[model samples]
Target: MSNVIIIGSGAGGGAAAWRLTSKGLKVQILEAGPSFDPLTDYKQDNSDWETPFPVKEGSQGGYIVAPLQPLTEETQDIRSWSFMNGKYVPGAFRTSFGYHHVRGFGGSSLHFTGEAHRLNPKSMSLQSDYGVGADWPFKYEDLEYYWRIAEKISGVCGPSTEQRSPKNDRVLGTPHPISYASQALAAGARKLGLTVTENSLAVNSTPQDDRADCNYCGGCLRGCQRGDKGSIDVTYLRRAMQTGNLTVTSSTEVLKIITNANRITGVLAAVDGVLKVIEADLVILSAGSIFSPQILLNSESVHSPEGLCNDSDQVGKNLMETLLATSTALHPDKLGSHRGLPVDWISWDFNDPISIPNVIGGCRFSPSMAESDVVGPIAYATRIVDGWGKDHKRNMQEAFGRILSISGIGESLPNSKTFVDLASETNSHGLPLPRINSYIDEMATDRLRFMMTTCRNILAAAGCAAPIEEFSSIDAFSSTHIFGTCRMGNVTEECVVNSYGQSFRWPNLYIADASVFPSSGGGESPGLTVQALAIRSADHILRNKGVQ
Candidate 1:
């Protein structure tokens, strides 16, 4: 049998490994971080007060609070807290964007919110329909079946009757019960001529894949201890390992992709401070948008001095950092924000490709509970409350169950100016760190403004008493949906990989992550799409290479 090495065990790598191994191919997965088991690592039944909050080391050696404050107990897990977390060299638009990703056995999938949304067909054909962004090498119809398979594998649940796109035919599992926050948003959306639909989530509603149903603990980001959330680690990766054809090596960092002529021969990796070479006929780079390209760039050789698949210098050029806009308002009625999933509803009114102008994407608005515990007191003491003592206490009491929030997740287009390159600095393993340079363009700014306005109106219609408050611009820390460093296209000059995610320069190397996305769909979560594409890539590999 032909041996395959898949780097990173997130949604993309896990899905690809599952598909390949199920077909009898031997697969080896190398993860840069330690293995994370939610059963043991997750803090079950622990409140924010019980968990130890993250504290960064000060320059003077004392401990200080981390800049990115997490109000949940999951932050207690180092694996979940460091999800997509990496260092970057400062460049143009450095201040505008920040990179946040998790590194571990499951990658960012371990800590994701589990929203599985399919891209609108129009978004797949961006150039033909919207006259912006590069069109996908293949249409959505080609991957529709894979999307269905991905949803099935992940056990996605959503409203069966609510149709967001005509192209989406995959039947979701049992729908989650509508929360008060969702109901309030839906009522407000209806008044404003918008439609609010049940979000397709990977979290279980009625129990599938041997996982328990969601208990509505509102602690999804903290890592689900009950296995209700369908992170690839608990789902596809577990299944793949059970097949006996898959082997996972955790805490092993791939330093370089060893190449012979134009074919990938093996990977040079550092495992527990020891360097070793693992042989493989095929290599799938699913190390995510940032590190995936970094690996390729670091794999320079005599035959490929620029990089393994950089004949056209398209390996790490176009980067799309998903834009996020948020709004907060105080509702007059008590909308229990601590009861259900962190994000329980979605509004697709702005996702329409044809109806909106300069709006090629959509946004999702959900109730926010970020300031629930210690942070809540801090928020009232600093900003929300007008006065001290009784005023602060009264404001806290009034806004406890009355505050509602919305986030507008907007689609971002590829810009040549934004990209990931090799930084002068190197990691502990001596591999160069990824230098990210990105900035929000006018189109993204306009879309964010529109989404913020729309979200404010929705909150107003939902009976919010206070004026909507818009928070800061989208940054790397706030935005986790990173796409398009190694984009796929019909031609190698314009993209890094082909439609099957195979590099034109090196046929044995494939990519199966958001890095292969030609265009970021209008506000749709990339988790499902990444898994779908990974499944398709596995099929392509099987068809072309066949079982040895």
Candidate 2:
């Protein structure tokens, strides 16, 4: 059995672990953060959900190699976001790098909203079809088979009747009832000649995989306490461990990838502050877009001084920080926005560049007030209701369940200005943090404006008052769905990894994360695709090993 060492425990790493372990490979997962017990460590009931947010990311057991931000919760603070300055424009793009980066055995999956998505065909072929973005090395059809496998493993829920391109033919479970705000948002979208469908969520509607059906009490932003949400910890990692072929070591930050003679030898890591080099027959990197390339850059040596697998000088280039926007207004009636899954409904009407008017890439929208507020009185006292004594209490009561917010995610083509590089500052481990320099060009900026306007209109049509620009999600670099850096392609000269996620220079090194994406899909979540690609990579490794 091949001894595989996988970095990260997010969607890609988890899927890879499960698939490789099931194939009888000896897999060891090294996570930078401590593993959490879904039954215990989750803070669904915590008022300050974002306390351990980006500010103190590395102060814990482990930390992501990202652009370090100040130890403050303003990144997710709705109050800090722009109120539109009484105009339609967003307050301001975020400057701090505050992603939904939860470091642990489950990685960001532990705190994600569980929106599983596949890249639309046009999105995959952005460069071929449109003049914007890099096209995928392979077609979407090639990945469809693995999409099915990933959805089944994730217990993703969606209705078969919804005929969205790249969606699963057989979902593991049914979708939950549309959230209260989504009900109105859907109607408003149809009025604007857009199609709305239930989101393909990796959350339970009916019990499956011995997990509870979603109670839909909201507060998902704090992370799912119950096992209903298909976090990597509860799903893939759990199942992988059950196979007895996978060994998971949390709080073990991979410092550098040690190599020799064009082959991966092992990873230099700090296992709970103790440094050691653990050998492996193969290494799979799934440390998301930021850290994956960061680790590669940090592994500089005489053999591969420009960084391993970066002979093409494309390791940390072509970074595409995820683009997102939110517009919110008070609904005429109490929609109970706090209850139910936060974003149960989504629309892919503009998931292709052709569908968008004067837009370069793809985009999608959904109701997100529930996700923004993160449940009951927490967001109100801290973010929304902004007063001192009795007035604050009254405003809190008024805004409690009457919020209607619309969120949009748009695709941005890789540009030269935006990229991942080593920061001048070093961390406690003396390793430099990955400095994320994000830039959205005029076309992407225009696309971004379009998303905000659409969201504002949706709220207005949905019977909400003039929607205020809730947040631009750009403060620092608050990217939740970042992509690219170690992009995959057919040409070894232009890409870091091959079509099968194998590094072009290193035979035994593979990558299975959003970093390999040629282009971000029309605002689709990368969770499903990340898992699918990892599963496919595992199969490729198996095939390379001559295992049928």
Candidate 3:
């Protein structure tokens, strides 16, 4: 038996493995996705991007490729609950949400674009800031030192002078030089009075922790072959294994939690279709926001008939997907090369106080990295909603590489009404899967509206053509930075976990994923926070010699 068994190897799990293993505790990481070695297993084929098997119905959109597989399957149509006309109603629409996540080792961070931002200060006090969401157990100041630990562990890089100018801020290293395209966008943003700064990335611009520097090839999305992106596989996971106290089981699916007397004794899992049981003194659930809560809901033990740690009935609530909108423009003047990370430059002025308070929600602006095929003098960028065909190619040639984009990231409030619960449906294993019922709330909607208006003005001033903006009212979706399900609070009556990520119902059970978030921050990417919180959780466990 291991001293600790961690479910999921994404942001939180990876961090906890390193923290606990370094403290000489036995740690076993059970990952449903296969182990991927960037050096040998790098594949560009559809299999590398495809979703795993055991496809379930009501998945609406064909399941998105889990991080493990990299292929697209036949798409599907589905419906979701919508908050319209001041009421919750059912609507018909479809999306490829699952496509954004990955299953294999390292979790979704393996494919993330590496935008690292801290949570908005106001986000910590949601009750005071907006009066709509709940307050966090801790504050931004509470996690400052841990944030630094996370940044160093992840090898993050950004502008030193600018990023560290704030008193509450602490950065790890300097940023990579800007590409020609990023420089141009920064100038244009300055011209429009928007604050454009270096993008805070969880990638190494220079060698750190025995890793190499970024080569400026801009292959972040497809994958970073150079091991410079600082994904978990290259960072914490590497060090955790070095401690010789970590055991990683890849391609092993966690079926459910086995609990007795409101405490977890072990977990039942499937490895290559073979069911097995693993017992541990402590269990930390870091299986991303969607799957973590889903596992709890599926595991209905005698002590927790509603599912483990779900006595509050807030297992999967307050879901938040980053509010994203892209605006494109053709400059007709080629700015520079586009062969680098997609998000080299970013703007933070979307949090401007002038109109942010009254907007339906809030928005954070960032510089859009240039795309390779869309960067020449004769080019303009356009998003083709329809399938790409000959006509699309023709349009592409007309505006091949001249388009520049500006984007906004907004926060979603914690709404008990928007949640995921066990559905009447079950998977092939006969486990009750989760049914997500949610949509963009008013705060998110208001933020998107403001972003559209601001993007248009920024483009006009940047000497580009009018902007093309996409807005979603009821069916909006984004792939990056999904969080919140098993939220943390000071009391068990309201939250599933405590501030240290210990389960309210089980002393030996913990969670260290995005699900522990009380509310998603407005501007900061959850990656840094997730890592920091994981470290903090491990520190708490070690100090107390495990949760009481």
Score every model by TM-score.
Answer: 0.88, 0.91, 0.85
Residue-wise C-alpha lDDT for candidate 2, range 1-548, written one tens digit per residue: 33999999899999999998998889999988876665455555566444332322332332233433232233333222434243222244335545557777778887788888777877787777876778799997899899889889888898765545655456557777897667977888888888888888999998889998899867565678778888888899989999999988887889899999779999999988899989989999999898898899999899899888889899889888778778777787877777788888998887877666877787899988765663557655665556579887887778888877888888878988778888877767899778777765667666776787788888878888875446663343567788999999998888999999998889999999999999988788889999999999999999998776
For model 1, the local distance difference test gives: 0.73
Local error of candidate 3 at 508, Å? 0.5
- Ranking by lDDT, best first? 2, 1, 3
The stretch of ten residues in a row with the least summed lDDT in candidate 3 is 75-84
lDDT of each: 0.73, 0.79, 0.69
Candidate 2: where are CA atoms >4 Å away? 45-94, 166-168, 473-476
After superposition, the stretches of candidate 3 with alpha carbons farther than 4 Å from their true spots are: 39-99, 161-171, 352-355, 369-398, 468-474, 546-548
Best by lDDT: 2
TM-score of 3: 0.85
Q: In TM-score terms, which candidate is top?
A: 2
Task: State which candidate, 2 or 3, has the greater TM-score.
Answer: 2
Each model's total of backbone clashes? 8, 8, 29
Residue pairs with colliding backbones in model 1 are: 74-222, 83-101, 83-102, 84-101, 84-102, 85-101, 98-476, 361-522
Query: Which has the higher TM-score value, candidate number 1 or candidate number 3?
Result: 1
* Candidate 1 residue runs with Cα over 4 Å from true position: 49-97, 358-390, 467-469, 474-477
Superposed by TM-score, candidate 3 places the C-alpha of residue 381 at a distance from the truth, in angstroms, of: 11
